[model samples]
Target: MQLKNAALYLLSLSLLALAGAITYFAASLRDINSSLPQIIDTVEKVNQNIAPLVAEAADIKKQIPAILKESEQIRVSINETIKEAEKLNSQLPVALTESKNWRILVPIIVKEAELARETLNSGIQEINLVRQEIPVSITRVESLITESRNIGKETSEGAVAGVFSGALRAPFELIAGIGNSVFSIFKSEEIILDNSDKEMILETVQALINASEFGKTTAWKNPATTRSGEITLVNATTIKKARCFNFLFKFNDQKPHSENVSTILCETEQGSLEVVR
Candidate 1:
């Protein structure tokens, strides 16, 4: 009976040890499973958070070139506008002169035409006599134009040439136009300067000079379509005085026509002239 009781106690002790080992191993396995599932869930949430940011970075990279191209286009357009404005600024003077009411001043021009008529009329007979004897006032006109060209060239090569460099730059520059006008006047047989006409033209010329002093001279040039004139430093008087002079005369059949006259104002360096050509 003693041996059986000892054997039963040993067996009970072995059974309790085995049950304790099994319970410890089961609890450790449960803890490991719970930790693994939590780690997996954390990794999944991290991937979800990073996805939108990655997509946004890719989208910005793709749009960068388009935004840069638009910026370049805007810069180019602004430069073009600036260039156009510069061009317009260069042409504004002539454009403003051409738009004024020149025809309204014609009656005033007619009233002051007598002296110019006499000068041109008296000069006609001389021109006709020369034409009959010489046969070529046109050639003379060409010669005068050539001489003027030489003078202009010489002047342009000197210190005073700087004054005309910009004037020669306009597309419709008046330098060539003035030469053409001189030729046209010489070609006409009916345009002559008589002695009486010369006096009248001179008187009117003086009055016009006076007008240039008190009034503004806009779009007038030396030597109108059929006249001859000059501009000099001597004429650069007070802004209210004559800064330039343009003499004119008329002729019929290469003879002096004392009754007809024409006169005009010319350009000047002064500031007060109304350049209303």
Candidate 2:
């Protein structure tokens, strides 16, 4: 009975050891399985994060041509702005010169010419008055000489030779002397009229010469001017334009010297007169 009890006790101990080993292996296997799933989940999350980063990098590479095109446009716009500024800068000197001439010189020259022309017209009026008076004086002198000749012919020598010798001869001689004196006066005055006409013509010619010289001189000295000068923009988008210079008067040679000169001078040329004088 003792031997049978020892063998059953050993069998019981073996079965207990087998049950503990099986429980430990089952727990260890469960732990290993849970750890493997956690590792796989971590790898999947890493792949998701890395995929977005790669896609963003690819997108940035694709946009490079558009960015470069925008940069080139900006450079071209900057160059165009610089060229426009340079064109404006080049016109500054011309604008400044024009301003100086217009403000100070042009008006003053015009006023001076106007005053000179007024004085010339006044002189012309006086000359015309003197010229008209000369013809009337010449006509009166001629009529008086004709009357004296007719009276001397009517008084004959045959009917009144001895009867008209002393007293009549004295009266006739005195009459003849008076007529001769009148003719001498007419001749002298005719010469004076010719001289006066020549002198007046010369004086008027001088005035014309003076006016023409003044016009030429003024044109040379004070040229037509612009307040702002022309600006030329060289860029592709820029537009071109034209400008006109400012002038107080037309500066035509055909026009009269002034309004006053036109009234006095029949023709605009030098030495031109209305009457023979």
Candidate 3:
């Protein structure tokens, strides 16, 4: 009877342990069931992300032949490059020898270039010097021209005076040939005239003859010497390519003596007026 009681107690404890295990398994299964939708959603997302990778892998697999062909071409190119590298290596000694020749010439070429640069600099300096002197030279040339003009003017005036004196002397010489008395009277008048008075008379004669119209008269008086003169343009005529004019000059001296002279003057080729004998 005691053995049957012990067997019943162990069978009841095993039943309780089996009920606890079933309860724990049911709770675990409920948790697992709760997480199953999220796990399925994550798996769907993984599949979506892996879709492009799967397509790319397929495409890469399809291009495997072309990739192998390109790789073969690359290997051929690499082989050619290596052969060229070997050829270059074989020529390196010659190249180095040529480079040595270039190195020897390089300094010479550089020296020549330096010489050329110096020559250019010298040429530029010369040009600058010429440029600097240009204004001075031009000024000198202008000064020379002005001096020449002044000299020419003075020479022309002197020549005109000389010609006029010669012409007046010729008429007087002709008069002296005719009669010594008339020449003596003219000589006496000249002797009595002051140099300044003669110059004034000559200037007035030139001015009136050059500027006055025919029959126009111009007069001058010097109060200091009581000398007076009147010049009149009477007529104009052409003679052998020269424009000629007839002028009447009247002179009065301090003694109140008066003299009248008729003179013919011509414009010479030199553009100056001189008495015509």
Indicate which candidate wins on TM-score: 3
Candidate with the greatest lDDT versus the true structure: 3
After aligning candidate 3 to the native by TM-score, how far in Å is the CA of 32 from where it should be?
A: 4.8
Write model 2 residue lDDT over 95-194, tens digit each, in one string. Answer: 8989997889889988998998898899899989989988995665455445434434554543322222221222211112222221132222212223
Which ranges in model 3 have alpha carbons more than 4 Å from their true place? 1-33, 39-203, 206-212
Ranking by lDDT: 3, 1, 2
**Model 2 clash pairs?**
none
What TM-scores do the predictions have?
0.21, 0.22, 0.37
Candidate 1's displacement at residue 68, Å, is 1.7
Angstrom error of the Cα, residue 209, model 2: value is 56
lDDT of 1 by residue, 82-171 (tens): 999999998898787775656667777886797788888999978887778664745544554454345447652443233222222211
Q: What is each predicted model's overall lDDT from 0 to 1?
A: 0.49, 0.44, 0.68
